[model samples]
Every structure is written in C-alpha cells, then in structure tokens.
Target: MRRTTNRSAHRAGRAGRVRRTATASGAALALALTAAACGDGDTTGPASEGEFSGQTVTVAGVWTGTEQENFQKVLDAFSEKTGAKTDFLSTGDNVSTVIGSKIQGGDAPEVVMVPQVGVLNQFADNGWLTPLSSDVEQDASQNFANVWKDYGTVDGEYYGLYFKAAHKSLVWYSPDAFAQAGVEAPDSYAAMMETAGTISDSGLPAFSVAGQDGWTLTDWFENVYLSQAGPEKYDELAEHNLPWTDRSVVDALTTLGELFAEDDLLADGAAGALRTDFPTSVQKVFGPEPQAGMVYEGDFVGALVTNDFGRTLGEDADFFPFPAVDGGEAPVVSGGDAAVVLKDGKNQEAAMALMKFLASPEAAAVWAEAGGYLSPNKELDLSSYGDDLTRQTAESLVEAGDTVRFDMSDQAPAAFGGTAGKGEWKILQDFLRDPSDPEATAAELEKAAAAAFKG
Candidate 1:
C-alpha cells in the first residue's frame, strides 16, 4: 500500500552542491591502493599524530540527492569539531568501478558508504576492509542486523555497521481513492487479490509496477516469497540451500502471476512494465487521476516520488502493511545503507572517530531530518522528526521486530544474485504474458537459478 498523507513532507536538496564544495575545497583525493601502502598492516587503534595530523580523509559513497546532503552535513559537523580535513567522493554512478580502482590501487578511503552488506564480505575477502571491533563494541545496537553482521564478518571479525533501515513489504495507496471506491485495506492475501480484482473491475489498474529495471519486480517477489515461505526459507534461498524449484517458491511465483493475469491490473502491460523505470511506474500510480490504485514498494519510494515529482508524500500517497500470506509468518524485508572503514588509509583514527560520531543518535537525527531515512540507531529519539510520514516510518521499524535483511543482487556470489535477479524479472514477465503456464515459467527460473548458483 503506497502511503500518502495530506500533509506535505520536506526533504533536503543540497546533496550535489555540498559534495562539490567538499571535494573542491582544498581536500586532496587520496591516491589509489597501488600508490599507497596498506598503512603498516597494523590492526592497532588510530594514530594520534604526524601523517594523520591536518590530513584529509577521503570518503566515498553512492548516496546522492538528499541522502548525500544529509551525510555531508554530518561530515561538515565532524570536520568542524575534530579539525580533521575531509574530502567527499560522490561516486553516484560507476561505484563498483571507482571502489574497485581504489582498492586495487591501495588508496581506498578511510570510510565508505556501502549500499549492500554483501560488498563488505567481498571487501573483507579481498583484504580491502578493516575489522571494526572497536566501533561495534562502542555502538552495539547500531551494528548490522544479526544476519548482516554474521554475513559481513570475515574470520569472526565484524567489518561493517549499518546506519539506516528501509521497510519493504509496504503497499502504498491513496486513501481518498480507497474511500471513493468504498474498499477497505485488505488484511489477507486472498482479500488483497479480491480488492485488486474489484479495482480492476472498475477498469483501473489495481497495481502499479514498472518492470523495466527488473529490480522493482524482484522486490515484489522477494517480499511475497519472504512472507509466504517465512524468513527461514528466505535465508535458505539466499544461501542457496533451497532450490529455486521448491514447491513454496513455485507457489509464490504462481500467486504473483495470477495477479498479473487480471486484465488492466497493472498500470502498463507486462512487457511495457518490464521496460518502465521505477519512478515512472510510481508516477502512474500517484499522479493526478492516478492510473493505478496501489503500488508495492519500499518506504524509500516515497522519497523518490516527493523528490523527483514535487509530489507531497502524506498529501499525495500513503502506505499500509502488506497483507499476511496464507498460513505464513509475517516478516518484513528491510534494506538500508551501511558505513565501512576501508583499508590502507593514513587517517584511520579520524575516520573511525567520524564513523562513531555518525553512528550516534545526534548524527542519525541529522540524517533523518535531511534525507528522510529511518535511523537504525536505537538511541535516537525519532519523535523529534517533524514530518509525520518520517515519524510513521520510524515507528514502523521499531514496531517490526527482527526484520529480514534485504537481499541485494550484488551480495551473493558474483553470478548468483545478478543472474537470478534478472531471471526472476524475466520469469515474471513471461508468466504475465501467459498465465496458463506459471509452472513452466517457474521451471525455467528454477533452471536458471540452479545454473547461476552452480559452483
């Protein structure tokens, strides 16, 4: 359910400007790993002086727009207090390329904003990240979820700390539209389908989806499968212990396929949606005289809509909890960004200090206000947030105990996630085109998943 409110939600727009200023203002871009030594290979605490003194620490991240701006504010505050110069490297595009070059050249930044937890493992495996035992111990609750922490740990040492969480299993819709249609939010999967059928019977698309990026569809499948099979099976699939052809997995795909088969159920045709971008599809659902009645996406989709389309979050759309699957445990699939300390930097202490500071409630609040992200820091009092939607999102996270971590396609072994991620979307598209043969589509996807996960 896309959650829309009548109240206007505010967000920062200074990300690009702040990044440009930070990068241009006297801070040097550290040489790549090849040009610099791995900093004595010492696992000791940060240095107190010399090369670290008056030295600028380069921080690389993929966050852009308001998220980047929010982080920049925090970094600016850190610089003001600590006198440690900082350089901002905004690698919005080609992040892997840039990070790979830095690690290979031995000039990786002191801290990096990692988009996926799996990347931390890959970095640790490649000796590109330092174990952040001190940081984790100092800020215990702010560390990664048990699953992510365990996954990110290399040789039993933690290397990354998550800073925020996004609730995915959320279905956003227009309350006014719902009222107009005289339909209440569905509480069960069967009811949800019935509601969709009713909405479609009115000649409106029941769900708004853009499958062009493929990841959007993947998100839907992940949420449904996670809800249907429960977290245990979800984890098994993530670890490749469960076959993609498992009955539960096929059932989930079939369920989604049935939704697709309903005429005019989705904003665009299955093939057209497969080619539409996320924002575009979302607009079709939230635009004036919305073409679709609902959209299933993460909490952050609100941000994308408000930031890009000048749409007010609360006034334009609202979200509801995804209905419970039949005889399945209710669990939310949550995704968020994390911070990591890169190896081979001179200002390690300063960077760690900055990281610890950023992990604090104060910093989290700053981020929440600036970027509209839900702070992962338990110590943060989210009540301070002025925006109702942001506060609601924060409350939802707290209310949801033990959320399942988001499965990034980049997190699994090289070929597994990326290939399977793409394959899942294709399967969805194929199933949509011919609902009579969901089993066949599921079988093809199972074969693809098997080959992708093959050792």
Candidate 2:
C-alpha cells in the first residue's frame, strides 16, 4: 500500500498529427504484460546517448528524497558527460493536476515520469505526448522485452518507456525471526497457513498485516486471484467486465480469509492492523524483538528495511515471492513508473537524449547501485546492484518471467482503483475487518466499482 493514485484527467487538445509513423511492427500488441528471464527480451542497447551540448532538458517525476536524489546522479551524469543542462522537478502527489495545469498554461516539462499506464494512455490520446522517436524505438526494442516496450504503446505508437519497475507480489520477512521461530517460507496456501500457525505459536504474531492502507488488502487478494483464478478472470474483475460477486472473486477472498481468520494471526490484532500504516507494519516485524515474523508488500520494502530501519538487507530482512496459490504457479504482480516526452516541450533534442540514456543499461545500473530503484531493462548488469539481496530480488522478477501482470487495481479507473473511502480501497478495508462475509464484501465492492467506473 505504498502511496498510489490513478490520477485520471481529461487532456484537452491534440497537437494536429502528433502520432509517429510506424515502419516495421513487432508481434501483435496485447495489454497483458510478462517478461522472460534475464536477457529475456530482444536485449539491445544503443551505442550511446546523443550529444546535446549547450542545451537544457526539463524532467519531472513523482519521486522525492532518496529517489529524487539518486536520479539526480543519473541526470548529473548525462549533463556532465554530454554537456547538457538538466533540471528535475518533483510534482508532489497531485501530479496529474500539476501537469494538466501546466499543459493548459502552455508550460509543461519536456519529460514526465507517469506512474500509471492507463493515465498515460489518456494523455497520449490527447496528443500531449510525443510518440517515441525512431532511435528511441530501436533502443526500446534492443533493451527491453516486447512487454516492456508495449506498456508504453498507445494506438500502435509508443509514448512512454518504463524507467523504474517494481515487483509487487512479495512478502518481506525477518530471516532471523523465521529461523529463531523455526518458521519457513511456504510453497502453497495450505503450507502458508501451517507456517503461520507455527510462527504464531512461537509467541509472535505470524503476519504483520496492514489494514490501515486498504490497497495492501487489494494486493492480498490480487496475488491470490492472479495465481488461482488466472489472468483472464483477474483482468475481467479489474475492468469490472466480471462482477465482483463472481465465484472466482469470492474464491480469491476466501483464500485470503485463511490469513485473516484468527486475531492472534495478526500483529496487535485486527484493531492495530487497522491503524498501522505501511512503514509501521514493516517495523512490527523487523523492529526490535518484534511482534510479527512477516509482512507482505512490494520490492521497495528492501530499500525501506535498509534505508528507513537502519538495518542490513540479507541479515536483518529478506523477502520471498508470494507463495503459490492452491498449488498453482505464483504470478508476478508488478508496478512501475514510465517516462514520457511532452509534445509541447521546447527542448525536444535534450529530452530525447535523456530518454535514450534511461533506456540503456549503464544509466539503469547507476540507479540500481543508488538503491531505491529497479529497472525493467534486462540489459542491466546484476553485479552493479549494491547488494546481492536486491540482485536476487530483481532476478526473481525476471525468473517468474511469463507469469506477470501489472497490478490489477492500479490499472483500473481512478475512482475505482486509487480513490480512498470508496471502491477497492474502502471495500477491501471492510473485508480485512470481517472475512466472515466475503459475498457481502464482494457485493459492496461491485457497487463501488460500478459507480466509479461510470464516473
């Protein structure tokens, strides 16, 4: 439940004929995304970023603090090596509003890191984004899989390139706690329950579930549904093409219920879970002689453990992909920020230069070494990562390979996917509070989704 938003907005006008012409096409593009192992895609890297000496590039993103600081190193490298002036701006939480207002006022950054593909596509549809340049297209083809390249595609043209990627279906845990309690990561849902019971018996709550952030509850259900019910149903539920009350949806909820059933199973019980924010949920397990042994979240948890908790990764904390569901293969649920070029920018050459660098492995390695980022570029040297733990985490994402999907809720409409106090967020919070009536929960979820989707 790290901060998330749909931020859907109407982009007013289209620059006449902003679409780039396609020469040769790759495989037919489908919105479903999955990647193979390392060097999985048609891995290619450009010779070098273009020289944009004596010019400036304006880049905007939602990152701040460490993320922003680390990215500055990349931009600084580009500027120093190529003599291009670069400025980076963090557009707080209301990125859509900020960018939209800028667009209306005839002032927008040359490049923007869009967090949601669905929202980016809306911007693309309005012609505010320039389609990928030919060289950029070639770079994307060389460095990324078709899935990564296509995530940025709108109407057969690519508009965004994924610069930062995250593997969301992961459970962060304390290796020390697990070993001390003789608890092991489970392989299946049943094994998870048995393991939870064992860990709880050791006097620590087995799971530090975060109920305060309802999106975590959504992830809890999504990972199960994607693995157990498969992608088609997962997509349908996300788009609301399938009703929330569907048996498949209930099955996902019911499977998740196993973890929520007993008060002792949760850290500080349901009441605390309902109040504990995400970072605190992590602290509960990795904090001093903790109350819990595990907390499920995304890959960013490693950075949180090391940077926020003043702990080491491999020794103090580690993570395992969400276990298999009902003996089915585990699905890799991912979320990432993609960079797009604004069609209306004044510095197109400098902007393209930066995009070229981002699509390459060398620059990605810099961010990788800086520790708060993950890149979709398979060309990245695993050894460049600051620690083996992070390298392993990245490897796992690629290893799960073909069994990948963007977070379902993240791809849905804003009101349905990202809004608080309604839709999936609000409804899933209720589910965590009371798993006894999933059918009712499903009904309420559908009600919210139907209304929001209409909006």
Give the alpha-carbon lDDT of every model. Answer: 0.63, 0.72
Q: Compute each candidate's TM-score over C-alphas.
A: 0.82, 0.86
| Predicted candidate 2, C-alpha RMSD | 9.5
Which residue runs does candidate 2 get wrong by more than 4 Å? 1-50
lDDT of 2 at 304: 70
- Tell me the tens digit of each residue's lDDT in model 1 across 336-392: 666778868667776776666655565666666675677655556666566888777
For candidate 2, write residues 77-189 as lDDT tens digits. Answer: 66655556666666876778888888889888788889986678668766788887787788777666555665677667788888888988888888877887797777777
TM-score of 1: 0.82
Candidate 1 has its poorest 10 consecutive residues by lDDT at 13-22
Number of clashes in every candidate structure?
Answer: 26, 1
lDDT of 2 at 245: 87
